[model samples]
Target: MDLSSVKEALAEKSFDKIADVCDNLMLQVASKGTAFHDDWPYAIHLLGYFYVDDCDSARFLWKTIPSSIKEKKPEVVAAWKIGQKLWTHDYAGVHGAIHGYDWSQEAKDLVAAFSDLYTKRMFQLLLSAYSTITIPELALFLGMTEDDATTYVVEKGWTVDATSQMVTVKKQAVKREQKVDSSKLQRLTEYVFHLEH
Candidate 1:
């Protein structure tokens, strides 16, 4: 999927579409390690961690997963370890001493849904505001270069300057506290940070 296309879809307030796109991108992370793949899963994990009130350790996991293991479930276990550590800190998120999680299909579905919804809605909310209201100002928001923003607009076909239309700010996204999943934080930490202790 094209970044510009995805970005455009986000700006258009098509969150469910973005989530589907993100799911595909996530599969790439599980398989290929694309740059887009690098961000979201770990970010979702960190959000789960943040909701649980321990971002520091979660941040650690965010930085670790890439270097940890090549398989999917070890990746899940690795993240769980960090999350458990964050829950209690002393050998917290590790395998033997996990905090509290039932191995249920519903729980798995919930986690998957939460992670997808969190990132999809998060980006859509942000981009929609920019595309509808303050597009020109988004470079400041992202701290990206003007050329990049211009390119984004050109490729994505966004209004880029919605001077003629007045978009009503709809309550599409329900605000919620994001807890970083210690599990994710731990994986990224192992893969990205290469922690040695």
Candidate 2:
């Protein structure tokens, strides 16, 4: 189980690499006609998927895990709870699962990284979806207290009304000039000409 590559990726907090390496390792191990023994780092692998926002892969991995391994490892089960919350789009539940578990030293960093990325992703979603939302709702989505959420959004340049406690999302309008690929256009033209003839 040459996990040097996995260890290197974990050291750098490169979750994409971790997910890829762990997945490849799983395949390699499976090709050997054996199951993932106790040596396998299931918690790290699951958290790696969550960190990369690959919930589908995480879910599949969980399903394919050996029942014996699942029963033996509480850490793996805890990590899957986070994935389950993520699959259900339960924002608060995601945070709850994360904080609820006592992760091993090997997996602690990845779990914290996943929580941070999840919060930031949710904040981005909130930006696109709401013009004005209450601080309590923002806290729920961001997994923070109302005060922390208010401070966070304010730091992100959102305006909060003192009386209403409604934080006005700062929407940045992106203006992209659509460019047509000339080669694609020429190919389309050629195909149309042939069809017409």
Candidate 3:
């Protein structure tokens, strides 16, 4: 799959093939753009949005970016910061960026409301649920698997096959096995209940 493959797929209405091909093409197209600073991180930020649940990592990646790049390159820095905030689920961050752009007021409101914690929690769930699945299963959910989900999970020290119903790189497995006080799950449920309400 390459640039031409993407164009042809879109022409044929092959939406399922888009993510796989677009990942490669997005990187390639971004590489061509002239950024005073390298746009690799910014491009990666875009990928983070597609993953939805990887925002913690995405947010950290943005903040860790050295001032060396942020200070010198306004265009790259601007895009990076906006995308990073979007990944972090800071909706106001996006509003600040696109406020004066051609977007409609409704678009701005939608962007502003998007960072609600429920949305973040949903992505967090996805990252946990799909992290340990086989290439085939992941490809089904993500619409692409040109990358290895299992390797990513292992690298993060998450255990797999807990239920053995299917591989799930559950967040519970990654956390240390401390005795769970009922209070903890109680608080967790309350938090989610509050968020949902």
Number of the top TM-score candidate: 2
lDDT of 1 by residue, 1-197 (tens): 34454455445544335434544555665576555443244433443453334546565655566643325444455445545554563321232322234433312443444334433433354556543544434433333345554454445445443454322223345679999999999898988766565
Total clashing pairs for each candidate: 42, 0, 0
Q: Estimate every model's Cα lDDT from 0 to 1.
A: 0.45, 0.89, 0.47
Question: Which candidate achieves the best lDDT against the true structure?
Answer: 2
lDDT, candidate 3, 21-118, per-residue tens: 54566557658883334533333343333334445554555575567766764543544555655566554344355342333332233223333333
- True lDDT of residue 52, candidate 2: 82
**Candidate 1: stretches off by over 4 Å:** 1-54, 61-73, 77-107, 116-124, 133-197
lDDT of 3 at 52: 44
Candidate 1 vs candidate 2: which has greater TM-score?
Answer: 2
Evaluation by TM-score, superior candidate among 1 and 3: 3
Q: Which whole-number lDDT from 0 to 100 does residue 156 have in model 2? A: 90
Per-residue accuracy of model 2 over 101-180 as CA lDDT, tens digit each: 88888888888888888999999999999999998889999999998999998999999998987899999889999899
Evaluate residue 7 in candidate 3 and report its C-alpha lDDT on the 0 to 100 scale.
Answer: 48
Query: After best superposition, candidate 2 residue 160: deviation in angstroms?
Result: 1.0
- Full candidate order by TM-score, most accurate first: 2, 3, 1
**TM-score, model 1 to reference:** 0.23
